[model samples]
Target: MTVRETAATSSSNYLTRAGRGRGGQGQAFRNCNVLFHILFTLKGVREVASGQLRVLQISEKGLRASSRRKDIPDQFYMCIGDRQIHIGCVIVSRKRGLLDIRFLNELPTPFVGAVAALEDPFALLEEIRPAVFGLDGFVN
Candidate 1:
């Protein structure tokens, strides 16, 4: 896994899987673009306690988010930016209250922009909102 994670030693297959495919010499979606304060929701079989999560940063393929609940399921569904659509995610790493996620599919460019375009919900205080672990498979 370590070798696969390293760009130098990573195979072409690994690169493709990572969305860093042919002709794109640099890793695709490696850069974290959205640094704005964004809050999104997480739903894991009613694991939500108002299931609000804070977005630390997000990229086209993944995101770093923080949650109030300690027990976030390894897989869950979440909204992208202000969009109502649910996207699947799988936890890649967890530490303290932070969750590092990989989207099941590469997000549309527009969706990524919407998250970056959003204003800080907490600072605004009165403000606004937003997986791939298909909720359809989960029981209530």
Candidate 2:
């Protein structure tokens, strides 16, 4: 039998798949299990669509989020309740207000940990600081 090395581990350090990322090809990942204050702006666009959103799911590869902001282009920079953490993303699918996006790079473990450690990720839902357009270009 081939041994598979999974990411999430138990207290004994044995490999396990529970609570780990699921980004397999053609896998239909469940969405909207968690909610945290998230911010993002349309990539390549001069902030035409920048607003607060709720992170439905987060993984090493990307995110499943819900946003009311309209006209979201194909790409954007997502901020996990912070202005400094700009994660470049590309839209994979959109329906209603749900946005399935893939990150340009694998998310660092520490960053994801920080998100999971938040006392209340959705405490402040009214603000997205530095509240201005930062990403460059436009989606044509």
Candidate 3:
């Protein structure tokens, strides 16, 4: 089997063994389920997109870490210069390895320019400090 298929099967086996299947119980199982979704979501972000909006490695790490909190919002914002810029909203599904991100508006000029110049967008996100504003949590 292909590497991707093997990885997927292994992940599925792990989830089943961890009691995260259809009829799983206990808080630990639930937490494992959430962590699985977060990890796969970041993986999708890293592997799916291209061009100016491709997710950076550091940004993926940040997203993965922040996604551990249940209170984090579905959207992300970047703090650039004197403005808090709305970048996009992310919707992650528990049963799928893909995430849907909808941009709130046009990306900032500087960010676009940087990407156009072939600069690492993830580094730019890091330098600017991205923030997530959710109903119950604010993470930077």
Using TM-score as the measure, the top candidate is 2
TM-scores for all candidates? 0.51, 0.53, 0.27
| TM-score of model 1 vs. true structure | 0.51
- The candidate, 1 or 3, that scores higher on lDDT is 1
lDDT-better candidate, 1 vs 2: 2
Q: Taking the candidates one at a time, how many backbone clashes does each contain? A: 7, 3, 0
lDDT string for model 2 (1-140, tens) is 22333221332221112113334365333333444434444544455546656776766676778876676655556654345446666666678778777766666544444444545556333243322322232111
Q: Quote the lDDT for 93 in model 3.
A: 27
The candidates, ranked best first by TM-score, are 2, 1, 3
lDDT of all predictions, in order shown? 0.51, 0.52, 0.30
Task: Kindly list the per-residue Cα lDDT of model 3 for residues 17-88, writing each as its tens digit.
Answer: 222222212211101111111212234356421112233211211221223234333434433322333233
Alpha-carbon RMSD to native, per candidate: 9.6, 12.9, 16.1
| Residue 56 in candidate 2, Cα distance off native in Å | 1.2
